[model samples]
Target chain A: MSATVYIPREATALSLGAQSVARALAEEAARRQDAVQIVRTGSRGLFWLEPMLEVATSAARVAYGPVQAADVAGLFEAGFLTGGKHRLNLGPVESIPYLKNQERLTCGRLGVIDPVNLDDYRAHGGYAGLTNALAMEPAAIVKAVTDSGLRGRGGAAFPTGIKWKTVHDAPGAKKYIVCNADEGDSGTFSDRLLMEGDPFCLIEGMTIAGLAVGATSGYVYLRCEYPHAQDTMTQAIATAYAAGYLGADVLGSGRAFELQLRMGAGAYICGEETSLLESLEGRRGQIRFKPPLPALKGLFGCPTVVNNVISFASVPIILERGAQFYKDYGMGRSRGSLPIQLAGNIARGGLVERAFGVTLRELLYDYGGGTRSGRPIRAVQVGGPLGAYWPESKFDTPVDYEAFAGGGGMLGHGGIVVFDDTVDMAAQARYAMEFCAIESCGKCTPCRIGSTRGVEVIDRLVAGDRTAMQQTLLRDLCDTMLNGSLCALGGLTPYPVLSALDYFPEDFSTPAALQAAKR
Target chain B: MSERKRVTIPIRVEPGTDLPAAERTAVLEAVNQNRALEGSLLPILHAIQDRLGWIPPRTLPLIAYELNLTRAEVHGVVTFYHYFRQHPPGKQVIYLCRAEACQAVGAVSLEAHAKRALGIDFHGTSGDGRYTLEPVYCLGNCASGPSLMIDRELYGRMTPERFDDLIAADAAGATSAAATSAGATRA
Candidate 1:
């Protein structure tokens, strides 16, 4: 057997030239007569180190990167195959603080094994949750998830168990598990990371959800933006079916669950649950009125359990490790780990899955190592485009759901995009409204007309109009949007807009105000 | 279990489909293949778009006819989503990320540079039909932004200089670039 080398096939890695690096490694090894086995695995989510490569030695897998095609010759000369010293060599893979410090309960399988390899997945405790769930009653499975206190990782922070119980108790012989993989958030990529890196985990998670809610059919509503993930997940689903982990009888347990992958065309409203169900039924991606919550009537009017990718992926661990074990990791009502995607201008951006109490300060400074531009960090946007902009004053805020909501910021998918002093908060506020206008489903008046008006008002404010008047009008518009819109697209757009106006008032001043201050 | 039978949606050239023979056949095939699947309209539209570059105007009524849906129903879905293009697109479509993460990293300047270099505005195709520029919210490459995708290929940490080079390389049919390696290696 030859020495084994691991390289990432994750979209981020490919974007940063891992495919070229893969070809380079193969070409270089052949030229040097050094036979080696190269395997393309999922990313470890330490994106700053990608296309981060690892070599399996006698003791452990030694790490070296960020590798490029040009460095292939030097790496071979340095005896990288034998774990030789090189400037790019970061030593062992596990010693890196980003990976070491993470509470990787849900993201543990990422980059550790071939994502499509069922045998490798099984070896790494993949099916233990399913194996355990197969024997238990459906209610018991629901009780375990409820007891674990896992809330929706999709930003709403709704308890997963209660949602499952609603569908379970709803009197229907036909129920469906719909995984919301329509991750359209600007700064969030945790769902894309899991679907591309640890795909089988999502497969297992959704399968378990089917059993819990008595649903025999499942569909993953993936956004068309993530073509790489679509390919990987489609392949992984096929592998599971062949292995009897999916379709008619899962793992030969005498239970039936069929899974399919459905693609969503570009529509941000589809990320909203009611809108998501409408899109799944082949209609215009419109929002439905919400008296009959999706738990009761969803996805073709069948009782459906709709979960975010991370919410479902977190289930296997709770079932395998027991509710108490999973519950013990976090603070307050938030149990288990949240896969926080540290993105944007941060120095060491990647996925950091920590328990609920982790602070934004720790993630920004300690893990992220501050801005990549080496400038004074000005603002951070937690969640996606809809999340509020946290000024430097709020950096110490913890990652708990209630803590964020208390601060007028919801932990809607944990993604924090950092910006330096060069950022224009007023401009960002304009964009928040602009994005809403562009993606609105046109189902309501407030979101549709108000967003376009919000942009016009902000433009007037930015163009040195009556400052106090414009501010009041903008606030009034945001109020209408928050209270009047049917879904979060219109509802949550106010968070970023109002937060900018409130916290960064200096950035909102008119030219007259600035000149008056100078005088 | 039986091999699932496909649902056949018969084509009606009601108001007359003015498409070329090859194009019409491909559209018919896509709709017929996906007819039996649940919520198959989106899939059918995707298939037609994938094969013909855009959803041609003539194919809509035929599609509506086959799916047992009205032209209004099919047209509503096609126009609702940003991904579907009504007219034929250029050889390459560039989805430039204009969202906050990309904006934080100088995407505003990058967007300006792209517009100037391509001689086209957002959603505009070049005179030569070489490229079409589209403003996208995010390409899921936020950490390495400014991000953009040329067709299905993703490019990250884009600068004006690198942008020109990538366009040149892509024009030459090269699949890779010098990849401004996401800034220097991990510290």
Candidate 2:
């Protein structure tokens, strides 16, 4: 028998027809009785063409994809076993534009090795970070992460190393490491993609965190929206446990760190770290006050390191390769690569991890290839629902946190949603308040009640109350939500609402009937 | 043995919603089964739609009851989520992703085109009672933007022209089935 091949059984691959491709390759290998093995590895982030297949050649592993089962026979006949090609030639998988352009820090091992095979992960540079981390003083490791300039990728851009150090220093007998996989943003799926595409990186990142913080337990609070991700991560965790990479006395270091999966109920508020902690304790998810910040009194009142999947996934690489290597990629203050999730109304949408400071023009025109409708671009929502809306004129804004912030957009989770000319900014603004009203944890007054009132004001404006006085009132309402709300949910809701008013005033002046109010 | 946790919180009911028992049970079942899911609200609502065909007002309390959650908790989930329906949906679901990705690609015009051709407003059912339309955020088919989900299958890079053809074909399919179902439901 030839060497066994394994590939990802994740949903993205399923959606891309990996099942049929794998089956076809198997049948072809069988017919020839060739001693060749075909493995279905997880996606390598080049999701543009799926059914992406890789072959173990004598020279290097060759890749081909967006392949149909119909093409398998031709591929086999074309000496594909020897790296020859039929039609689906993507020449060295690593060289593909989508793969090569990415400065994959967190997703480095994804789509590269067999997710189920621990041996494969080891061969391709897995667990190296954990070994390196274990050898160092926890303080040294923390210093390296802090110097790397990595921030939380799950909406909030809090410095990850600072959070870890706080939890590490917090006085507590029991501590915890929690991976927030509760990615509930409307235009975001990077967390799910990372977990399913490269589960090990996250595991390694969490293990490193546990060791750094003297925590004995870690929990991955994954959202249910990603059923496939949940199953894939669970399997990866099991494999890690079996191989002694996790569980008691990991890798003979005598360091005990146990990890478990805590599924979240479908509350967007749960994406907030403290609420996630409460949910892990098996209670209803509601946002808690800050200052006690999760690092001090989190997860059953024990010091906890709560981080998003991407932030934790970034740790292993920083530990293994050192902070300088990671720090070399990004621009200005945002020193590291960001796995920017390109989504919504664009021609080409997918994850693009580049050094920060890429312009919106590049993201939209060059990478996204303009709108799918071949129409004029209108507005873009940078960040998630709580992020700001920018008109076409503001496309010059750079993606760095400071730059985006200066341009009135917070780089929340790096989710950029493009809109074409046909968009009604007014209606989209209304949706912002509506979404806030629906998702507000109701712990704060501004978010709990202001969101509903905000929606009504927008509704009234749309219903022909576009008088100058009324418009001013609407603007004032947005400011209240902006300043008064506790979290970004309320604080940033005005970004979209106000931006719509500022850039698309024509949309606000309700048809002729509504214009009468202005007169 | 794991201890059962008991927690209680007050909840508010929406202004107007009084549904029957069966509908409530169906909604609750969907919510309870899915509550523990990370980002579960949308999928739970989707499940409720699959089970009971619509989201009834009473489903909120029922969901609260089963999950040991408050009425506001259930209400927040049901209303916060865009997928759930407080009223009955028509036979087929045609949800368009209107988030920036789709909009950047022309989903706005397509939505207008769809609404005009279908003769139904956004979030409204067709007059013939065959299709219910709704707006969604994103489906993660970013590379193929301007996408729509008919039932659960994502159709990407859609244009008003292509959607017209799709709607025509769908209308043809709906007509034959509607003829039979309409007769049965009305009769």
Over the stretch B1-187, how does candidate 2's per-residue lDDT look in tens digits? 9999988775544422355667766666776787766445545666776688777775666556555667786676566434456788888878776655555556678889989988998889999898888876555555555666664344656789878877777767752321211012111
Global lDDT for candidate 2? Answer: 0.75
| Docking quality tier of model 2 | incorrect
Judge candidate 1 against the unseen true structure and give its global Cα lDDT, from 0 to 1.
0.89
Candidate 2: where are CA atoms >4 Å away? A1-10, A28-36, A77-81, A85-87, A513-519, B1-141, B145-187
Candidate 2 lDDT at A367 equals 81
Q: Write the per-residue lDDT of candidate 2 for residues A1-519, one digit (tens) a residue.
A: 464444445445554556666776788888889776666566665555666677766666677777767888898788776678667877777777666777777777777777767888778788889999999998888888999999888867888889989988888999999999888776677787788767888899999999888999999987654556766788889999998989998999999989887665456777888777766765556778887888999888889999999998888888889999988978888878888876766666677888887888988888878865678778888888878888888888887888888887788888888777878888888988887887788788988898999898887777776566667787888778888888778888888888888888889876753557646
Worst 10 residues of 2 chain A by lDDT: A3-12
What's the lDDT for residue A266 in model 2? 50
Work out the TM-score per prediction. 0.96, 0.79
lDDT of 1 at A217: 98
Residue-level lDDT of model 1, residues A378-493, one tens digit each, is 99999999999989999889999989999989889998999999988999999999999999999999999999999999988877676668889999999999999999999999
